[model samples]
Target chain A: MDKVENVRLVEMGQSNFIKPYRILFKQNKKDRIWDGIKVHDSVSVLIYNVTRKKIIVVKQFRPVVYVCNTTNNVQEGISIDTNKNPGTKGITYELCAGIIDKDKSDAEIVKDEILEECGYDVPIENIEKITKFKSSVGIAGCTQTLFYAEVTDDMKKTEGGGREEEGELIDVYEIPADECLKFAMDESYDKPVGMIFGLHWFHMYKLK
Target chain B: MDKVENVRLVEMGQSNFIKPYRILFKQNKKDRIWDGIKVHDSVSVLIYNVTRKKIIVVKQFRPVVYVCNTTNNVQEGISIDTNKNPGTKGITYELCAGIIDKDKSDAEIVKDEILEECGYDVPIENIEKITKFKSSVGIAGCTQTLFYAEVTDDMKKTEGGGREEEGELIDVYEIPADECLKFAMDESYDKPVGMIFGLHWFHMYKLK
Candidate 1:
């Protein structure tokens, strides 16, 4: 553990892609407040290919993971050579998800997400709510709802890899049902909690 | 589903507690990007009272949940009243958690959080990592790690209800292990995915 000091609000900025705000709040049993950020509410979907007995997954480069990887490298005294996209380590295996600030139902929003991100036209009725939760309770307090949807080959409409106009370069993958848990749990897998939770949900509730 | 138009970065602001950052991203089949916010990363812990056969939980007021309740009111054509904290409906039942940016090891930070927020002093060696994932992949992109720990009566150090100086008015609840699953699964339980996941993990891995 490192020495922790008090935190407080210092500054904030906004961009078309995202907004960055800072907070100063206390730390280390101190009376002062330290700084942190707060983002938006979002949703993540677990899409099961019931017909194929497989799981639909997505992989994409994430700027946050990239920067975090880069930061870790710098901390470990690794030499930084590539000035261009040095944080290329951001690619992540994640569930289909999107923010929830729109004026629409969670099912409707996830239905569109399924179509655009995975190229499946899952109906709103097919999507079941697994649970609604706050993603990161410690730093930012935003709500995220997890959804479950079972789809078959009949639901496939397009080669879903996300829209190019949105600057998204998503690669979609489908893992066999028997291998889904192992694949998601592999130590080498670069995955998020939502993805792993989704896989676990499939194993516990859907695998019967 | 209602019509969803493109979103643009509108405004950003900072308060003593949280910072609000907005983003404009594409949504629906439309070519329009939607507006949303981005917060920060966090952590949550599921503490098990091994001797007592119970799970530690926390309850507190959350402005975000409160606002969501209030916004639902507006959508339903309910007139807004009570200018002085009208969004009082922001209470949440959640696991014990905190931020990771404090320079402490995940075990150390969560260890302190468990003690501070829930009034338990479980040692670091007893804490186990369940999994790490992004809280809101669609928005904040910050990571949250879930941890599990088991303790006994000897671990009790204080009447855990969160520290007052930090402005945390937390109510600690310990549900018997026999009732943990149902309590966590109750539709009325205002819990996060991590908590439910923890409970599920407890059921699948720890209980038997």
Candidate 2:
């Protein structure tokens, strides 16, 4: 089997929150038909509060899931809501996550996010890695790092203050462990990595 | 506490697989201002092979993860590659996955993908869900459904014909079970959901 090679980035450009990069490639097999391809790397996180018997989840807006859900509804014989306008379905729920900033350790960025997004101060020792995974492939390129920590109920209430940026209204919730698992299984939870790690932990530690 | 009002999708549109949807808002105490928001939703899958002790994974040209990795290298004093161009990174490994086609159960869609992408005919009963989680928020609106299945080693030989329309080039491999967890943990693995499920199953059934 031929080994898959990694192409290096040659050019890059970024705006406020969006960044684009170029990659170098070479043809491998005689199939020269498959010469080279470019790809993207992304960062994501998962936070679990074991002591509180809950997980820190955020409810916000999501545009893609909304479209898929709407399209599914239309195909399933469910009536579409005609009064609503475009981009309204972007709200979403997910674990505290952000792209990995350049030059920052995964732990450092995740630690900061815990405070900014969930208002909790998580010690590095307590932030155990659940796993690293990919988020999507169609267009956006991101890989997520899922982590867990045991936050007490007291911590949930005292450090519950969250970030409020322009057009970003985040609501932090201390979801019950069982309910969190149910939500993860049902795909009702907002983010994909959150549900993956939540259910993973449940399967590993909770489910007998 | 005021009840969290149910959000409704108002309008939606899709262009070249990049979809953006609009949502309607029911006002509550949380906010007295905005009447609606825009959102997006997407789907992903985690394909596992229990019989072969390997899991299906994909390595693609990810413009995002690649860029992020390059940025990290620049910060670390590593020289950037100057020979590459900007394009989608196409890597190979994994079972079958795609954005949910409108109007189908995620499971049903994934089951079909297993046949289309992996060339396996496993019963749906074997398709165990690991979790549903989100990928990113600051940029894209999407969620993923991670899943696992037990497949025979011979199943690995099955050809996963690529989806040309979608530009998906798929290949099937039956990696060793013990190495799967380690492979999944590597930075290159990127997608952790399938690994998470693979590791969870390993700990529960194999390693335990």
Candidate 3:
């Protein structure tokens, strides 16, 4: 689903996600400033299909990845052409996740995300909390709570892709549990830290 | 060492870290845009002291964390008082990490960081490579290459507390291997995802 074209990047004018700030603090009488952005805290899930013994994952195009890979130092006055920098660089294998913008509990949000993104109806009681950690503390120190759940083949109901109305085009895929660590380490596939950590956690605690 | 004072947060001005941008693209002939920031790619080390059978970590005061914990919504023209919002929320136990600004190999840079931030002298050969991952994909997607190294008490050449010239004040400590997962899971200790993943990796592959 990465049929991306007509890519253009520019200096940010209006942003829906970034709220940049500078914190000035004095430690041991020395003044220091740290620059960061305020972002939404989110939740992610690592889903395992028990009948097939596979890790269900979602693949989609990420704009930040595309922009960073295509731009060199983000030099001003220079425009990027998609031909020179292919859009394939932006595609990544990610865990089913959603930003915490709803009033529902974190578990409910993730359960709903699983159904919307991967076409699975996971029971709310079956969802297990793994842990939550501060993500990317250097720039944006936001929290991301991770969860785990086991699903069977019967649980699948629809042809899994992200919500089309939201302009999302996600592809559903799976990886064998035994090969997850290897896949996580592979440089060919771009991935996030949460996915890698979840894969390792699964091999350590699950798939016995 | 979270003795912070005179904490004030304001709208970002000439940030040395954040460079915000907006990207516009067409996927399947549908127009879309994404907001993100360009930040420094970094390096982190998960150091395990073979002689002590413990994981070496660094605790420091993060300005971003402190400001986020204190400020409500980053409202403009409003000043923050540190007394009302304690600075302790800014303190975190993290892996020995440094921004990849220096013109050296990632391994050499991480080795130097171990000495400056954690007071250890790990050789280049002992520094093993872990998988690199994209961090905080939604906002500032930057590459963070992780490494692992084992050291002995002899490597403790100095009292590790970061470089004073750079205005860094870090405390060095260790955690027992058997209890590391529990410590990483503890909500009382503010930490980064890289540190948690590193701890899990150490238990899965490093510890005998």
Candidate 4:
């Protein structure tokens, strides 16, 4: 029960566009107890530009909000009235991020994500591993690798618009450092990680 | 398109612990769009016991490491692993949060979460909405509600434990404000949001 033991995958499935695998392991903790657990892995990125003093972000429709609002009978979740379907498309504002593809370095994956999501080519100066976090535990064992990047104002403009994907139609926007924090703290923004971390780094390096 | 509209949930189901639903909505943006999204309408509590100058955090296991770890052969968009069983049991660190039940108010939910997750009691002051964030976009549209709680040192004890429903194995740990940031940034801590915002708010309020 003292040495490293072997691990095995138990149940594996992909549903709702998420690939999740459960594992069973014999842990040599104290007396070689049999244990099993599930985990989900994903990736995220934070794009920062030094020149324009702005960060790249995107807005998209999120179906979950629509569901939450409707099921809870909450009038404020997301406006998804059948009569107003087109306009009330799920709106989610987020940072430039994507699942890590095989054969690509974290930098490469994030770089590609920057282009696909925000159309930016940022030199991955430093891959500051922010935190590997779990988005939800009750259902999916999904965890994400969060990283930060450095860019400039010219880089922001040159990157241009995002490449529209099959089911995704996104709009790229840039907000100043101060405003980024303001937006992140604002409830209307919906998603806040990218802006939260971007503003933190800005204050840590620039303001300080 | 300029006015707000209502939506209805046609069906709801649970997929691997996450609740998914189909919705029918009407809007003026384009046309009718049937959306299916995963809804995990949960609450995250950032507990700060001002009297103790400490915060509560929990650590558990995560399984997504295999996929996230590039060294593993989970590339080419291969969602399943047949060679090795990647088990999902690792010590993860995170904040005290629980899914919001249908009948509880936000304040009531947080109060209940505090006791169930960490075995503490505090008078509900006010629930400050941090932001509703989409943990991942590539998958279902699941969003999380983040909140903060102010408590006193008298509210906690040395051996705080989780509920029987939580498998009765969670070990609640109190972290001082100064060191919470470092722990939150560490990869070993399974959950990062509670620590992240906990430290952020501590520094922001302390400086003021």
Model 1 TM-score, all chains together:
0.74
**Better candidate by TM-score, 1 or 4:** 1
Best by DockQ: 3
DockQ of each model against the real complex?
Answer: 0.15, 0.16, 0.71, 0.15
Ranking by DockQ: 3, 2, 1, 4
Candidate 3, which segments miss by more than 4 Å at Cα?
Answer: B70-72, B77-81
Tens-digit lDDT track for model 1 on B18-110? Answer: 433322212223222222223445678889998888888888755334434444322211232325333234456788988776877889999
| CAPRI class assigned to model 3 | medium
lDDT of 2 by residue, A53-163 (tens): 666776655433443444533121233352453334444666776656557778777777777778777777867776665544434435566666655545543444355
Off by over 4 Å in 2: A1-51, A63-68, A71-91, A102-105, A153-161, A178-180, A202-208, B1-64, B71-93, B100-112, B121-158, B161-166, B177-182, B186-188, B192-195, B198-208
True lDDT of residue B47, candidate 3: 91
* Quality of model 1 by C-alpha lDDT: 0.64
Docking class of 4: incorrect
TM-score of chain B of each: 0.77, 0.62, 0.92, 0.66
Better of 3 and 4 by DockQ: 3
Q: Write the per-residue lDDT of candidate 3 for residues B112-141, one digit (tens) a residue.
A: 999998888888999998979887788867
Per-model CA lDDT versus the true structure = 0.64, 0.48, 0.84, 0.53
lDDT of 4 at B97: 76
Locate the minimum summed-lDDT window of 10 residues in model 3 chain B. B68-77
TM-score of each: 0.74, 0.63, 0.94, 0.72
Q: By summed lDDT, which 10 consecutive residues of candidate 3 chain A come out lowest?
A: A71-80
lDDT for A38 (candidate 1):
39
